[model samples]
Target: MTDRLKDFIENNADGFNDLEPSQDSWNKIAARIGHSEKVRNKKLRYISIVSAACIAGIAAFIIFFGKPQNQTDNFAEIPEVLEAEAYYTSQINMKKEQVYQMAGNFPELKNEMEVDLAELDTIMVELKKDLNDNVSNSEVVEAMIQNYRMKLMILEEIKSFLETKTDDQKNTTSYEL
Candidate 1:
């Protein structure tokens, strides 16, 4: 079919080559296709902004309103778990401060290595909810603990990378004039 169409175009080239649709026809075509570039861009920007806002709103909702009731009966190892949680939270906070300082020294590195801690935190919260419903479930408790450990590990790795990077710069004694 494409070959037939090509032959037809070749045979009828003289008839169509000089044909010009008028300005009115062009305007009608543009109207039918909604061909204004600015209009398309504006719609795109609007959609992007709205989509971002929706994501932020949903995240906020999960963080703030998704927690189950705080009944002590829901967790078996409450004291030990809470203590571990506190320790990991403190470690994460310390690393965040370090990341803040590192960001000043290495903006691109900080941006590239950063993780969405909020999402992890949200999953941690959701796991707590699951733990609440299943007090005897050791797996859920282990998962929650694992999440905390994973977060601390990530933070420590970033800190170690930044520290080594700075140390490397300090150890390098060469300068080109």
Candidate 2:
């Protein structure tokens, strides 16, 4: 079939080569495609403008009607916690980092202490939840503050212990030569 088609093309090659569309026909086709592209572009521009306007209206509504934020440490409902929450939390984070770095040398000890610390953190979270629900639970607030202090002290002790162990290991290794 392909061979027959090839033979037909060869026979009609002169007629095919001699025939060409008029310039007006080419211009008409170009105008049709160009007009459709322009319409598509305009539609996209209109859609983008509508979307932007909708987003701006929603944002304005939120800004004008939203309540002022009052942040607390895991206690969103309490705003009078003396801002000590932020300070203690940051200190805990710094100590946690130190403990993590020291864990590379003392995995067993760090793991053991981490288990205890996790329990204390769980307790603190529960206390924070209580404060969120009540906003003025004296006992839970006290317990949470104590937990933070305990964690800080524990981290400091662990850091000291790791430093001493690392120094002893270095000294013992060096003296063997």
Instruction: Report the lDDT tens digits of candidate 2 across residue range 1-177.
Output: 379988999999897799778869966785677644345435434443443344334334433443433544444445556466777889989988987887696666667567657756665665565566544455455656666676776677667766776787879967996
Candidate 2 total steric clashes: 0
Candidate 2, residue 111: Cα displacement in angstroms equals 1.2
Quality of model 2 by C-alpha lDDT: 0.62
RMSD per model, one decimal = 15.3, 24.2
Query: Model 1 misses residue 146 by how many Å?
Result: 0.7
Kindly provide the TM-score of model 2 when superposed on the true structure, using C-alpha atoms.
0.51
RMSD of 2: 24.2
- List lDDT for all candidates, in order: 0.61, 0.62
Once fitted onto the true fold, the runs of candidate 2 whose alpha carbons sit more than 4 angstroms away are: 1-82, 174-177
Q: Least lDDT summed over 10 consecutive residues: which range in candidate 2?
A: 54-63
TM-score result, candidate 1: 0.51
